[model samples]
Target: MQKLRRYLALGGLSVGMTVLAACGASPTATTGPAATTAATTAAATARPSTAPAASATIAPAGVTRTASASVTTPAATATRATTPAAATATRAGTVTSGTATRTGSPTALVTPSQAVSNLQRLDNSRQTWAFTGFTVAGLSGNLNPVFEYNGGNQKVTLAAGGTNLEAYQVGGVLYVRAPIGGVIQADASNPLAAPAQTLFATPAALLTALVPANTSYTVAGTETINGLQATRYTASVALTDLGFVNPALAGQGGTAATTVWVDTTQGVLVALQSNITAAGSNTAATARLDVTQIGQTPAIVVPR
Candidate 1:
């Protein structure tokens, strides 16, 4: 917590300045909400596969929000654990299901609820998966966070500048380790948990919010991403549908071209990409999150 505090303190003034500059400058920035939201939600593959060009003119579909449980985070502190001084590489996940279940036909359209439900269900099933992505907005540097989940166990490694923090939630115990502060056990009630949660929750929650009941998307065939075959869906939605309340976008009109990949058989979310742009503007912001190594991560036993 101390190291994280110091890192935030050092960047606080710079962050503020960057925001002001972004608001005044032209909108040609590569950073925006899409990046930040996906950062909390997913990752990039070390060996990425390209999808066909995505379009926003797909016929809109009628959809409604479906309730899903929030991904649980540990609430109690536990004994100290070994602390690594730097970020570590995570292996891709394996499929917990013996045979992945494919969903929808090549011609079938997908609803936002269906897409989100598959993601939430995967989380609930205790199926192991991992993702790594970076969030950047305004002039702030990118924050790359890696997340891995296995049943009730979860781990996240967040780094910015040279400060790195690792957190693990195994069963009911939570442990946080930073390069400078060693390790401390904490729960959801700890104030320090707030920032970590903010960084972690954005991706998953934002993906849900971004694909509200009004989205229209179609399957674009199956592609292999990090060893998993996932059906890709593409859509274009108004910025409002994505929970963006920007007055400028509202008045000027904006849209997001989104593409997502879901496990063919298991329906788990495999990757997501969104490009947001206001009409009549040359500038656009894009965000992407990719999940790999479903069911294959090393066990997250109580950190030793």
Candidate 2:
């Protein structure tokens, strides 16, 4: 755009001068119109500029030819100076994509396609992981969950508003303790059976359930989550992507903008945070999941 033009021209000039200065002296530089005219006139008068004798002297053809080349080369070389500027423009990429090249304009921004690909690969190599994250959004205000999954077992604690609930699952049996429900027992409805069904199923489930449709994921950077190194990725996805089978979760359905962290080494989902909005409302709800334990956690015991 208008911002980049001055830079490209200056860059090209700098490049050309450097190339010219390195060449030392070439014959083309010294040859000029005046020297050429003098030689032409001498030939017409039957005289040589370097005379052995008027009739016997040979013109210094080599020197005259070299000088002629040198003079013209420098003019043509004015274009070369702009070469460096062109290179810098490409690097800066300040302009929009698919634009024609101009003196000081840029081309295109770098895409996050590679980072998304890496995240997909991590999903493919899912493993046992534990994470924790605090989330805040307009509809859902401040809900935090810390959970761990080992094979077919699950232990999770959820706190929302002023309500707290804890659940433990061993094989097909699930145990829940809550302020309103006291000690509740449930059979089947196992998380392992929902979707991929394995250790650190979160990465596979979240990716399958709620990756935003027709959107790009941005790799914000890396961070240490609970003493573990993880790569952070963020995306805005529709509410439907969560694939909510649970009545409670389905009721709160809305578009969610999520930020997730995955272990760089194992590619397991280490932490996730999301802001959610309801189907017909603009109010946002926030939720967070952090797996602080990875591949290691104490046994899950059911309360009798």
Which one wins on lDDT? 1
How well is each residue in 51-125 modelled by candidate 2, as lDDT tens digits? Answer: 556334335666677899998798779778788889888866755333443211210122223323344443122
Clash count of each predicted structure:
17, 27
In model 1, how large is the Cα lDDT of residue 248? 34
User: Deviation in angstroms for 236 in model 1?
Assistant: 1.0
Q: What are the TM-scores, per candidate, against the unseen true structure?
A: 0.52, 0.40
TM accuracy, model 2: 0.40
C-alpha RMSD values across all candidates: 52.0, 31.3
Model 1 residue 261 CA deviation (Å) reads: 1.5
lDDT of 1 by residue, 262-303 (tens): 766665666777777766776455666767666666777655
Candidate lDDT scores, in order, read 0.57, 0.53
